[model samples]
Target: MSLPLAPGLAGTRILLGISAGIAAYKSAHLARLLKKSGFEVRVVMTEGAQAFITPLTLQALTGEPVRTSLLDPEAEAGMGHIELAKWADVILIAPATADLMARLAHGHADDLLTTLCLATEARCLMAPAMNQAMWRHPATLANADRLVELGWILLGPDAGDQACGDVGLGRMLEPETILAQLLDELEPARDEALRVMPVHRDLVGRRVVITAGPTREALDPVRYLSNHSSGKMGYALAAACAERGASVTLVSGPVTLSTPPGVERIEVISAAEMLTAVESRMPCDLFIGCAAVADYRAAAISEHKLKKTEDASGLTLELVRNPDIVATIAARPDRPFTVGFAAETQALETHAGSKLERKRLDLVVANDVSREGVGFGGDDNAATLLWRERERTRRHTLPRQPKTALANAIVDHIADRMR
Candidate 1:
């Protein structure tokens, strides 16, 4: 399953403020990186910073005109500062010099950047940069603490060689590091917002049952057979469902992942146990079979660990077919809107459609596991959705994306189809 193309930073707005400091030079690269990563970047330079780097440099890098004043009548006629403040999703102050930190900490709105910081409801993050002595100054430390107490997220003034011959803390983090941290802070908020969107919130108050990971088929007392399913996909589905306010029961096989928030998790080791768990939590509004269940198990159990014999003859064990959990549930008179997963290496749609019909599933998420980032242990996936529309089978291709993103899309689709 090859996911569709995505602009990683589309619709995300970032207001970048540069304060006076030699490290202000780094803001250029940061602006460019933020843009490249899908953020709408707008740069603001403090008066003192213009001496270190030209506004033209940042403006050119960010593709937006630089804003550097608190009282430009032409702009102020429309209360442009207020508009700029309201437009930001996050305000980042890189190269936040000691003086600038103090101004913001004391709630000074003397400049356009500082004024916007005061006006905007967006989250504020500062990356302090200065000489070690100045950085270690008690007043500076107090200002930093004050800013932190005011709900400002302060990124590192990392320890390293300073521009001033001396070496210690007070170096600005690399542009890449700042971008990664920025995304980490904002992505959760974005996901949370998406969770409540009217279009994506259809699952609210609905009951969902999701099975994930691989079941172990016992071969002997100390041996068992299992696939490479890491259970990440199923876990993501559970989390996505919970985010949409669904009452979710995640029947998970042996995996190291934590239970998703707002989800009830049932841990099981074998196919029989998994089926038992699913049956007990039944009468769900939706059932998603994402687990990679072993098709067969040993016909008989061995009380002791099987050992190699002196003759070295290969051991032979009889096997029996395991219960088809998803099909059994779908066969019920009061079955939920049943869904299943098909991880295939070849003929993906063909095999997936077959499974959808064979199991009588309302929807099937078919993944070409052979594609990179689609299946197994990875944090990302790409999938094709197969659902019966009257007598025809409809397919939708979802591009490769983080598992959480894919899960949300899938859940939204399920909701739409149900409606």
Candidate 2:
């Protein structure tokens, strides 16, 4: 599928940096994808990259002349690097070789790409592509981390088979993945302009707490009662808030989703444990109850496996209610903007509206979990946001998108409400 370009990139200039690596072949596809997505793409190559991919290939895909030299007289009409730097909305380097990474880390600007990178005020993203061992080496990892610290978005060196008959994690991500990430970085909802607004900074120094995933209530040590929630939505919220300069604490139930880049994560297994985790982060600016906590738990613990008798058809077990974490937090005297999620199978609005009132939430995000490709483990989600006032309800039908995109949208709504 053709991924959507960043809204900001329409008619926007993008400088594509291709470095020497076997993965340089993929840069041709990356350029084509960028052009198809409405970007005015300009390709810049290093001397080493020319060995793997011809300039003719990139020139054809980009529909623009490729620039590979810092000393080109025609390109230097207006101080080439500075002009190119000012022309771009973003600088993306794919197949960023280990050598190039080291040069960037040490502030080396010997080549055209590095020079443009250093001179640009635009956002920068790098997709590192190298041999597995080179990627794993301490120096490369440290350089990558340093780039991140300097505000560069590192796309990936995903794990997979390598060209040299070896495999483990140094493969450059597919072109589509890199393009998707670039779109995200370029279209971040909470832009720098928003940051300077007085209303935007309301949650500036506030500690925001969130819960995510399905809590597993053990029926036995081997089995548990849990839903199919992937914890993606909640994790996305945590990451979004953190990006907007909020101090965030994520109390997450058992999930495979990685912790969002800068947020603090506390892991828990059962509903009771989740309650404790939420309670511990109280008196924050915002509290989000996104976890699908089990309403009932096994009343008694079992020390050992119970034997099934041939004569018995079934076994009886008592159940008890788990603590209502959101309600409890809302009841606090100094409550933050309380948000809760209502995943319903039927009568979505009516049920969500009632839940919003009963739970005393500032806002509730309700969705039909019954719909295919929207809720639970799916990457995309569609939600109807209901405010406590009862008269205002907005339907936000997010396209089948990455969880992070949905998360950004959710946080943007919250930020708007705060205003």
Candidate 3:
């Protein structure tokens, strides 16, 4: 979301630092996203980062001249690093390489970026990206711990497939995820601080059950059908609820996201498994069905992998309807306040309203997934929340925003309704 409407971050200055790594390419997008969010962004690049991505690219994206050399006589005539350092409200190093992290931890100021880091009093944040092995190394771990102890915030070294054809932790978070997290960490204006108050424990005695991600429909032991659900929204909701002191149980489908702190995560694969898991966590105060459960699954499980026949031109498999997880829970006589999500490509309101009534849901969050930059596998989302109040249906519209922000707003609404 753009920060223009946010009092504290409206004109926030961000010093975007890029270090050497394949992930440096993502820094370009990071710069753009920050700029789009109304943050004044300036970029400083390590010499090695220029090898992977050029300063010109970032300069163009941020609309600010990029700084490369620490001792460029023309720029340093005014102690450019110090000036840039003083200009920033926050210093964020994306693709903070292992070498850079080590240097930062040990007080090295060898380059413009590192030098600015040393000269800046602004809050320091890093998004570390390196080979999985390097990230897990004893020295790297020590440096990371030390950086945190020194008041530096570590964004993520997300786990997943890497450029080296090996998969594990060490990937930098997506630009949108980084932006969302940065906003969440920053304190809003005092008058607006209560909007996302840290000390609030409004859900202290509540129990929340949330389902997230895309359920896989097994076609065989090796193949399955699933959607492009990253489980980000659901996980965000779980985190928000947990932060508010709610006992949150997250019934999640296969997704790579890290479990949020204080949340109980139960992993499952198929829609049936998710349904069973949710049912087992029943009798909760609130139930949020956010999973993209497949509408159909293989009607019959094959004993072995199906092989293509030389004589046959094509093949067909029978499919059957899968159980409607949210509807089933809502139908229960002991149902809690049930919330459902309707992710539609078209006629969003019509579909969502139908689910709210047909499934007997307390609320239905209608999402238009066809929109770019928000929905499905992305880090941002927009929705129309529909619910029945008194004798008529009421709706609230939430503009496109970081899933974390959206989740917080959704929870706040739910809390208000519950009260």
Candidate 4:
């Protein structure tokens, strides 16, 4: 999903600091994504990160030569470190490794990255990436807490499979996810302080399930059919709900979107797989069908690639309709407050209204995909929410905003309805 660029970061200068860790590889992508999101990115890499990724790669992505050594004589002209430090609007450190964290905690300015951090007054954002054990270490936690107290933004050590072949916490957030978080921080909600100060425990203990992305229907061993669903909306909803203290379970189709912090994500592929996964986690307080499930799948599976024969003029494969997952869930006796999405080209209200009634959905979010810039695969979305009664319906024409912002709005509406 495309996120609306915040004025706070657009054309703003950002100094990206890369440190040593397995997650350094992600820093390259993060730098590129940041540049694409309209930040002027300058990369500063520690010697350790250079061990894993090339300075050339980061330079290519940022369109600026990578700065590594603190002692480079040419770079030191006119007090380069201090000058670069003063030039930044924000200093973001990705893969802020355990070693770096310790150094930063104690104000150790041994390297260029650390020295720059000490020299700069720019807002700092750090993404701690390390082994799960290292992340949980008492010293690391204390240092991180101290950093947070000092007004540094901590992005994530998201829970998931780590490069160390162990699954738990301590995974660096994906580039797009980090970019979204950065946007959120830079362009905080107009009423962010007020909203956060209030405790809306309306969903304090509620279990909410959300599905996201486009399901892949395998056509062969290597080929598959999928839609343009980016999973951005669903992931954003998950994050929003979690922020509201809801226990969120995200049953996601294949997408590059990262699982929101504090969300339990169950990854699946085909529509059938999604169904099985959701059903296994049923009896929740809410179920959101945000994924674009494939309508049909190959009727028969082929073990190998079907080769063309000399006499064959063409090949036709049969297809069968995939199960309607949301409808089936809504039909259950223990169904949660069901929400579905309707993406239409024409007669959006008419079609979405029908779907709402026919599928027994408590709420349906309808979007006009036919319009430019506001639907399927785009970061921004404009939705007209539909319910049984016309008076109860509400049309929310969201500005060309981030999908996460839209998701937060949708979740707020849902929470209000639940209350």
Model 2 TM-score on a 0 to 1 scale: 0.55
> What TM-score do all the candidates reach, one by one?
0.55, 0.55, 0.55, 0.56
Model 1, CA-based lDDT: 0.84
Candidate that would win on TM-score:
4
Off by over 4 Å in 1: 1-199
Q: Provide the lDDT at 310 for model 1.
A: 80
Per-model root-mean-square deviation over C-alphas: 14.8, 10.4, 12.2, 10.1
Cα lDDT tens digits for candidate 4, 1-419: 33657555568899999999989998888887888778899999999888999999999988898899999899898788998999999999998998898898888999999999999999999988888667656677677766766667777667677888876456787777888778877876743733333323345446688899999988888777788888888888887776664657799998987667857788999999999999997888899998989999999868787777778588888999999999999999999999999988999988998888889998999888888998877878888887765556545554556676777777778887877
State the weakest 10-residue window (summed lDDT) of model 4: 193-202
Q: What are the per-residue Cα lDDT tens digits for candidate 1 across 1-419?
A: 11111345466789999999999888988988888777788988889999999999998887799988889898899999999999998899998999999999999999999999999999999888888778657688678767877878766665456789865456787777777656656665544633433323455446689999999998877899889999999998987776554557789999999766445678899999999999997787899999999999999989889888789678888999999999999999999999999999999999999999999999999998998766999988999999888799999999998887888889989888888
* lDDT tens digits by residue: candidate 2, 1-419: 35655455577788899999999999999999888888889999999999999999999998888999998988798797788899888889998999998999889999899999999999888888888678757677677767766777777655557898875446687898787767756676534443322222234444689999999988876767788898989988886776564557789998988765435678899998998888887777789899998989998767677668788679888889888988888888988899999999999989998888888888898889899888998877888888844466545554555666767777888887876
The ten-residue window of minimal lDDT in model 3 covers 190-199
Ranking by lDDT: 3, 1, 4, 2
Distance (Å) between predicted and true CA of 332, model 3? 1.3
- Quote the positional error of residue 46 for candidate 4 in Å: 35
